[model samples]
Target chain A: MKGIIYGLVFFVSLFCSSFAVAIASKPIVVASTTQIADFARQVAGDRLIVKCVLAPGADPHTYQPTPDDVQMVLESDICLENGLHLEGKNWMSTLATDAGKPIITTTDGIKPLAISSEGEMVADPHAWFSPKNVAVYVNNIVKGFSQLDPDGKQNYEARATLFLQQLRVLDSWVRQQINRIPTQRRILVTTHDAFNYFCTEFKLNANNNFLSIAPVGWSTGAEVGGGMTPERRRKVVQSIKESGAPALFVETTINPKQIREIAKETGVKIGGELYSDSMGPEGSAGETYIGMMRENVLLMVNALK
Target chain B: MRFLLVVTIWVVIVGGLWGYIADRDTRRQQITAATPMDLSVEGRFVIEVTPTFSTEKDPFALTTSDSSVPPLTVKLNGMYIDTHTQEVLRGQTLRYEDVSGVLSGHNEIYVSASPPLSENTLEHGVRVKLYEDSTLVVDQTVWADQGALVSGTISFNHSADEEGSHDH
Candidate 1:
């Protein structure tokens, strides 16, 4: 009886150790944002372990990389970042480079929407706002994973194809939902110019050149054309008054003081807190990329329609 | 006796795990490669795609930078039949003659098109009319919700006897 008990214990320990080794052997993929992390997980599935540098609702524009983040990148096999300056001061790239880890820019191969900031045309880093651009992100991530783990290429590609189809469905759903709002009343006002891609894709603010209207420029950080400007504030106020926008909105990542003050002065109600730079926390409606877009569209339609 | 029992238990556990993993791998492979439809199944079929409303480019459509990829895609039995890159007017019935892979017993025609985003409040549909040598075989209208893509599969059974009769 004693020998049997010992043998059973040894067998269980061996199985447990083998399982742990299998899990540890899988490559780790560290992403810059929660949304990127979600996309990586969707493609990589259980083949690769995915980690996010920025927490949910954490602003990537002004996110300061911590020592823990550096250690995470150093231990990671690969790093993914939304290039075109979405990460403030190129923090994600800098971390990956310093750690000597291969980095994949998810937004690669996208025909970026350019924004005129401080007399210079800068590529808007909010390409994920449009699902079409997100297809590019998923494709790039698939390529990155396949290159790293050649054996998992077929697995990654299959998952990416399914995710791409889901994105197509999401795009069509968003359009149908946005169609609920009348064209003339489709004025989208938010904290920053984060929704420029969204507005361009959905034809919001058609009267205002089919672009987003906000008090802040593209980035929330103090880049050349970023941060809040007096002229930009005046323009936002003027546009809201001229267009008779039904409501204004604040972002979860940025401080709502500026937009709130504008709303108070202009007598426009704050429609809702939108998920911009980051997604909602775990268990929230805006937790996933599709969920965030759906919630944002629903909020906008309800307020404007 | 104790040694034999322990070895038997170990073999059973390990063998069960191996069987589970092998089964899982086989299932995954099956999902990865879709069952290829028989394109050799021949029929003189003409599929007509008639939109209830004008088809426009969906702003949020998942398309590559490739200019030639059409906004409207129609597939017959999992094979590409025709694609329209530009706006397909309401009255214009885009027709296709060479539709392959259609099974003789049961056939499927898939239609996916972007309805005008501006007309999202109103439900829209695409009328898929299939004619077997001028004899209408299948007439089905696939509808989408107010603002969604008009995408659905129209299935019908085709028999050799129904070639000239409008039975199916």
Candidate 2:
């Protein structure tokens, strides 16, 4: 009996010590969205452990933080978020503040496209749609991570350099792919305003003033400048009818019913689902950021061209 | 005795996991560091860029403060050699001095530029010519599918001294 008691105490202490060691060895970075988490992972590599508050295909505009997310934030050294109110009601910022963790806004230096909502213009938060904007995100993450772990600065920079080059390549490739669509047929109609950056980058939705045609506002949430409205829906349908948009696309994170209805009303086919607010789930082509963009472009070209 | 055995088993499992993770991390870092950029210089060379389409700032391209940067990027042996602010018109040859980092024996020039997406229906290309002093050492045209960015590599051989002299 005495031996068993001593051994049990020893084992418990050893286990706790090992757990502490593991936690201390690497710092944790909690990201608000899967895309930001993916970018952090690409730059940090194995130096930092990156965790996403929102799971794959989860809508950032409507994401509610769970108790687990709070716990994760509590343990994380830093938090990253796509600001401009991408997080509905600033949930990520609230969590980070409550947990006393520094929150880095990844979209720090991007020139956000403004969208009008109810006579007021709001900065669009879906900057990742343009690979150029994502480069800004990468740079911000590198700076944030380097501040946290100065020793790993060179490693982070090297990884970021490579990733930036890849982004340039992806940008070039996407331009090439978008060229396949006839100039007039380059119209893009999606479920929401999340594609304004993408359409503007690729020169789509010419009839809609070179922006995206969508029934929903920038955010699918009930934010001030968000959610679907009857006026917006009517405009989308009219724009599609006038532009002769080849097809309409639904987002994986949003309900397809709205887009389907619009497509039916406009007499156009659903091009395909796009990974907008979030990326696709694991084992899917849209798993990584690059993968998501590539698949979206391929689907657009195939449907429109 | 049972508790002692359980503790021993846990130790082995935890130790193995740590070892595996450490090894994996080291391997990843090594792989990242293995690819080093070749910055060794051979000599001065001139590169001419002639675009088949109008050059404009790609809204999707990586932003640079220099507004005069032409739509095209010409890299010599992985280094951006064209930094001139001059506008490269369609079929107009714009010359730049690629003054350093020309590797002897075999050299490569990478050219990438976005053709206007509006002209996606027409296939476009850019002709790149490399001249060492007046002799054209390498001439290659990089073409792109209708609506794609023009990206291709131009390779050539040059036999010169360490001082970049062609002594007969």
Candidate 3:
């Protein structure tokens, strides 16, 4: 009887401890991608428990809503999403709908550009890539946090103010980086339509076949919808040659084979990797939005200049 | 013992079903709530490009709407202006709440209190112009790092440069 009583007490203590930890945890704010989660964290400060559904290097285009993701949304206070049809069409709305949380579309306020490649007006979701669009995102995030946790509204606003300062520094740094590349060599080439806002903000043209300004909705796994044959590869090579871009770049998610082939064919070096559609892994250089932009500018300067 | 077993089973099954139903209902309600109030609003304000005087909690107010319509559960209201005031706001607080959200978006509610003129004016207390399909809502604060509003060619830049600074 004494042993039974001792066991009950021990179990109860363990249960109580577990419960205490869970209760002590802050409300989670989940974003669809790392770039957003980073921004949310900046605005939310210590008050919010923030995370992204798409892990580093994971493509946001094909991000399937996992059961765990749904559960996370269900439990989280807010879900930040890039709403220019950024999270593909299917997974995002479902997750937002399932979670019942206020899914904040960060790019809702701005007049988004309909960057076209062929005839169709391709949707560009890479607004966060550009500091300008990110301003809109930062605002939306602050608003979301304020609504969800009004008690910490003051803190959210204060932190957002500070983060904006850092972002301003980052923008000037990017402009400086672009200035490094001679005007003639100011051509940005990368995977997919991720850098449209970046190009628009920085005055660079998105004229690469491999990298379309519009959301063509192609993952690196497939050859941009269909297979990229030798002929299609020839066009990319020819464009790079005619444009005289100082460098051609590959994205973190895409395998570097196609871009490498284009570079080899065109005698241009592949200018490292760009954080398109997603941020870098935790502890990496391009992990946060500002860090990602800083790293991108640094890479662009080193490659083009 | 048999009755107790039946009761426990009934409770468990019924409770699980109820939980599922309740969760579904909750998500639907949230979506429905967001769906109706798709009305867009835009508010604009101009601050001194470089305020020598400290703006610690300076009331840069844009009197838009008084809180209305179940408060609409304000989504976001960050500001993205263009200027060189980045250095000015260091170590300062920029607190915005329900009043802040209304001031940024929803100008119709408080248009009466707003300055008489309908253009960007300082003494006019941030003149506002409304659009039926289109509106301008700039209450969110974005840094020079990521402050660009894409409307035709109007880049908010969120900078305080003299050229970028339009008369508010």
What is the per-residue lDDT of model 1 for residues A82-163, given as tens digits with 9 covering 90 to 100?
9999998999999999999999999998899888777899999999998889988988888888889999888887787678
Tell me the tens digit of each residue's lDDT in model 3 across A123-197: 667777666567668878878877787788778877776676566556656776677787766677665657767
Best by TM-score: 1
Two-way lDDT contest, 1 vs 2, winner: 1
Output the better candidate (1/2) by DockQ: 1
Distance from true location, Cα of B9 in model 3, Å: 41
Where is model 3 more than 4 Å wrong at Cα?
Answer: A1-25, A206-226, B1-168
Task: State the fnat of model 2.
Answer: 0.10
Task: Please give, for residues B1-168, the per-residue lDDT of candidate 2 as tens digits.
Answer: 676676676678678989999999999999998986664645567878898988666544433233543577888878887754444677888788755767656778888776665675677899987777767767778888645567788876566654334321
lDDT string, candidate 2, A1-305, tens digits: 66556666776898899898987889999999999999999999988999999998888887889999999999999999999989989999999999999999999988999998678999999999988899889878988988899999888878886787677668768888888899988988776778889988888877777797764333356542335578877776776676677788888987777668778987999999999989989899999999999999999999999
Clashing pairs in 1: A176-B147
List residue ranges in candidate 1 displaced over 4 A. A149-162, A172-185, A216-219, A222-246, A257-262, B1-106, B110-126, B129-135, B146-149, B158-168
lDDT per model, in order?
Answer: 0.83, 0.80, 0.59
Task: Supply candidate 3's per-residue lDDT for A126.
Answer: 72
lDDT string, candidate 3, B1-168, tens digits: 555555555567567978999999999999887854533423343221221122221111111114221200112233332212222332233322223222312232211111111111122121222212232333222211112210111112222222223212
At residue B3, candidate 3 shows an lDDT of: 50
* Candidate 2 CAPRI level: incorrect
